[model samples]
Target: MEQHNRFWRIALLSLPLGVFGLFVIWPLFSSFYYSFTDWNGFDANYSYVGFDNFAKIATDRLFLQAAVNTTIWMIAAIVLPTALGLMLALLLDSRVAGARVFKSIFYLPICLSAVIVGQIWTWIYQPDWGLLNTVITQVTGEKFKYAWLAKPDTALWSVIVAWSWQQTGLSMVIYLAGLTAIPGDLLEVCEIEGASPWQRFRRVVLPLLAPSTVVVVALSVINSLKGFDILYIMTGGGPFNSSDTLAMHMYNESFKKYLMGYGSAISVVLFLIALAIIGLYFRQLRKVDRIYG
Candidate 1:
């Protein structure tokens, strides 16, 4: 009976492992294999070109531009949403009146799909009649009309603004959870010692929230790296690929341009980059834990 139970347990675990191997693991290795080829995604005339795709990606001017834009997006995604979220969390956690209502209002954006948010922001960014420009002109009493997402200079930043709008709510919720987990006794002790509000927060609240901060930062970094739907809907990597993120670039190369091999190479690079970021995040997290242990 014990052997029978052990056999059943092995069988149950093997099912998921087998499925993952078939679906996820197989595709990852296959993508690496295809990255070295010149396949057009379909056809019997495919040939392995031996690192030519990676070589091309290394030298491609447009790919380099996309990398820079992605980096900017990553930074903005990390900084802006985090700052806004922390602010909101601190305010709401103070037990202010109508705080729940404000929290709900802020979090509503997170429930909306990224594509829907992109469409709404697209209308807001319209040149002459858009809400943003219209409000700017009204407030400043000067005609200031420009295509927000069309210009190369403002394209990436515009998308980042929209992305941050949705992401801030998520960050706020995470920080709120962290804030609530903090021991009330610690705050009371700080107050008893006549510690200033800023000092208490800086010394007690922030340090205790390290785990939550690590999770939020890691999630934000990964999401920023994989940003696609919003960019796809808003700019379609348009205006001379000004808003092209790595994910969008990969999609365009694979489906639109029919360079499946090169697209696979791009995907591989993205995967490696994500892995490196995650690895670094864990390393820092371990160091922080040691210092605070």
Candidate 2:
């Protein structure tokens, strides 16, 4: 009877497992297979061209530029939000007057849809009558017309600023949770030892917040790598492809161009990049454990 019950339990669990495999695993493996072919995402006329798509991606100058832009976005996204979030977290955690309200205000942006944020910022970045340029002109007493999202020079950075504004709230909440988890005893001990606020943060708070830092950095990196919706809605990977990232380029190739095989190849490359980043994160975690254990 026990063995029969166990068999029934296993059978019941297999339903959801099977559904997941069919939807997720099957599509992943199929895409890998498709990457080796020259499938136009329709019709039956297709031939396997092993590694040709990957070779093209390797040789494509536009893809290289997209890769470079993605790297820049990743760096800026991780560093700027994290530093600002840490500062904000510490400030809000002090329990000042109306700090709760302030925290809510900052976190409100995180709940806004990326498409909405992109559209709003796109309007703000307009060269002639945009709010940003208007303010600059008013303050500086000169004409400050500049094509923020249209010019190759300022396009990428313009997107970065928008991305940062949307992402900082998430980092702030993560750091705020980390700050709350710190032991009160430890903080008191630091104070008793004549540690200044900066010294206490450097020596005590930061070391204890390492785990939160890891989480925030990893999430920031992954989100930055997968940056698509905002870029897609705002620039559509252009004003001459200056704002293209790997994700946007992949979407353009796969869906717009209907080159499913090439899109699959781009997906595979992106998967490897994500895997490498996750692997590096774990390796660093291990190193940290060894040093601090």
Candidate 3:
């Protein structure tokens, strides 16, 4: 009976495993292989370039801009969502009317696909009659028609705002779970001891939330790296490539420009960056565990 179950288990896993290998693992290896070649993504003929692509990366001004934009993207993505979520979690976790309904409303975005979220925000940001502009016009008593997505200066920030809106709920839910795990008795003690709200939050509540913060930050990091689809839909790295992140740049180079080899090199760099960040995060997590545990 045990052998029969084991065979069934392997059989059940085999298809998904095979599929994963074919799609994900194969593409990853292909990217690495092509990174060292001058393959234009078509034509059987190509040459081994051996770090030539990497050399070009050093002097490519657009690459430098993309790198800078990526850094800003990651930083803003991590900070905005995490901070706003924590605030919302704190607000909604308290005894307020319709808290449950509010939580559900906030979390609705996470259930929607990225495409849907992108579309919703795109409409909200429309220049002429969009919700945001309309509100601004009403408040300022002027006809506001500034194109949020088309303007180079504001495009990246506008998308960042939309991203924060979608991601904040996930962080909030995680933080709420963390808050619940804190002992009510400890909080009661603080209150009885006449500890101010800020003091209790700083000296007790915040430290207890360390685990949740770690998880939220890590998710923000990974999600920010993969936050290309919405940008693609919204701006396509437009207005002189001001909003072009590393991933967007990679896509443009690989597919649009048909510079597959150079794009592969960018992908490799991005992969290394993501790997290093995750590694460092896990290392710090271990240290935190040792100290806290």
Candidate 4:
């Protein structure tokens, strides 16, 4: 009976495992292999020009810029939404009036696809008559037609803002859950001990919210790493590559420019970066679990 059970379990798992290997594992290995070659997508013939593609990275000005932009994006992506979400969670958790309605409004964007959010923000940032500019124009009694997504100076930051808006709701929700899990009795004891609101929040609340913060940060890191879609839809790494992240550069090289080998090299670099970040995160997570346990 045990043998039969084990056989069935393997049979049930085999299909999904097979699919995962075929689609995900295969592509990943292919990327690594092609990174060593000079494989233009259309050509059946390619040369194993090893390390040449990787060497280009040292002198590639655009790649360096993209790397810098990606660094900025990751930092902003982690900080902005996390800070905003925590603030919102604290506000709503205080039994604010119409909290449910506000929560719904804030969370609505996260439910939408990145493509949809990009389009919505695209309209909002329209230079002439978009929502943001119109509001600014009305408030200042002057024409405010600055193109948010069209100019190199502001394009990346603008996309970052839009990305933050979409991500904040998820963080807020996670924080809210954490807030609810805290014992009201514990907070009452702090109040009885004459702890001021600031002291209580700082001393008692923040420490208790560490677990939630970890989860929020982890998701932020992962999302920020993969956050290419919204950027693509909104900017396409345009305005002279001002908003190009590593992923965008990879896509442009592979698909648009047909430099598949070079693109794969970029992908390998990105994957290693992501792997390092995630590995460090997991190490910290283990420590947290041990402490919190």
Candidate 5:
């Protein structure tokens, strides 16, 4: 009977394992192999020119700029949304009236498609008749107009804000779940001990939210690195490549410029960076888990 059960279990897993190997693993290896070649991404004839593409990356000004921008995006994306989400989660976790309505309103942005969010924000940032500028002008009685998505200095940050708005809901939901996991009795005990709200949160609540923090941090980092759709639609990496990310750079090289080999190299670099961050995060999570346990 054990043998029969094992056989069925293996059989049940085989199809998914095979599919993953074929669709995911194989393509990943193929991209790595092609990164060494000078394929234009379409033609059948190509030659291996290894490390040449990678060498060019070192001197490529646009790539360098994209790398910096990506770093900024990664940082902003993780910090702002996570902070705002935690705050919102705490607010909604209370017995405040209309908490459910506020939650639904906050979460609505996350449910909208990225393209839609980009378009909506694009309208809001319009210099001549945008929602924001118009509101400012009306309230202040002074002509206030600035192209938020056009200037190099403001473009990247503007997009980051829009992306954060969409992402904050996800963080809030994750934190809400984490808050639910905390025992209510523990909070009551803290109250009974005359601990201030801040002390209760810092001493008891924060320590217990480690698992949720891990999830939120990991997801925020991954999503930030993968940012593309909003950037593509809103900025298109415009105003002298100011808002371009590593992923956008890869796409332009591979698809737009047809420098498949170079693009593959960029993708490899991105993958490695993401892998390193994930490794460090997992290590940190282990430490947190041990301390909290």
Candidate 6:
């Protein structure tokens, strides 16, 4: 029996381990190697240029713009979704009527596809005949048309808002779970002490939700870095690439412009950033674990 059990254990572990190595590990190393080359993706013949791709990225104007936009996205994803989700969680956690219905309504966006959300928002932001313009005109009794997606200034933010709306539901669900985990006795103690609502929340609640906050922040950062599908479907990184993220820049470079090596370098940089964030997440988790213990 022991021998049979050992065989099965090794077989189960080995299968997954082999698959992970073949798929995940192989692609990562291959991409890293390609980042140092001048391969046009299809060409069998290419030069091994040491850090030339990386060097070019430093002075690339399009890349700089994408970087800035991605940074903005990261900040907005962390701040907006977290704040809004927490507030919704708090509201729903209270003794309110139709809480389940309200939760479902807020979480509905998360179930929709990014492509669908992008397409819907695109129509909503249309200048002349869109919903937003129609409402504005109705309110002010003047036909005020604004080209939201077409403009360089407002394009990135418009997409960010759409993305945030989708993400808010996920954040709210996570926060609700965190809130549910809090002990009733702990809350009762605060009430018994005659602690003000704000004081109790500041002193007791926020500290307890630190783990959930870490998870939400990490997820937001990763999602922001990987933002592509919605932006691609909506803008194609157009309007002079104002709303282009690093992922979109990589796609445009590799597929559109046939600059595979340069795109690979960008991917490598993005991968490094994600890896750093994950490392920080683990470090934070360890600290939180220690504190809770």
Q: Report lDDT (CA) for all predictions.
A: 0.91, 0.90, 0.92, 0.94, 0.92, 0.93
lDDT of 3 by residue, 139-241 (tens): 9999999999999999999888888899999999999999998889999999999999999999999998898898899889888888898899888887799
**lDDT-better candidate, 3 vs 4:** 4
Q: Against the true structure, what is each candidate's TM-score?
A: 0.95, 0.94, 0.93, 0.96, 0.95, 0.96
The runs of at least 3 residues in candidate 4 whose Cα sits more than 4 Å from the true structure, single-residue gaps closed, are none
lDDT of 1 by residue, 47-126 (tens): 98999999999899889989998899888877988889988999999999999999999999999999999999999999
TM-score of candidate 6 on Cα atoms, chains taken together: 0.96
Relative to the true structure, candidate 4 has a C-alpha RMSD (angstroms) of: 1.3
Model 1 worst lDDT run, 10 consecutive residues: 210-219
Off by over 4 Å in 1: 285-293
**What clash pairs does model 6 have?**
none
TM-score of 2: 0.94
Q: How accurate is candidate 3 locally (lDDT)?
A: 0.92
What lDDT does candidate 1 reach at residue 60?
A: 95
Model 5 over residues 1-293: C-alpha lDDT tens digits? 99999999999999999999999989888888878999997889999997988899999999999999999988887799999999999889986999889999999998798899999999999999999999999999999999999999999999999999999999999999999989899999889989999999899888888888888888888998999999999999988899999999999999999999999989989889999989988898898878866
What candidate 2 gets wrong by more than 4 Å, as runs, is 1-5, 282-293
Clashes of 5: 0
Which tens-of-lDDT digit does each residue in 52-124 have in candidate 4?
9999988999999999999999899789999999999999999999999999998999999999999989999
- Pick the winner on lDDT between candidates 2 and 6: 6
Worst 10-residue lDDT window for candidate 5 reads 284-293
Using TM-score as the measure, name the better of candidate 2 and candidate 5: 5
Model 1: lDDT to the true structure? 0.91
lDDT of 6 by residue, 1-293 (tens): 99999999998899899899999999999999999999997989999999999999999999999999999999999999999999999999996999999999999999999999999999989998989899999999998899999999999999999999999999999999999999989998999999999988999999999988999988988898988999998888878999999999999999999999999999999999899999999999899989975
- Residue 231 of candidate 5: its Cα lDDT? 92
Residue pairs with colliding backbones in model 5 are none
Off by over 4 Å in 6: 1-6
Error of 1 at 10 (Å): 3.0
Q: What is the lDDT of candidate 5?
A: 0.92
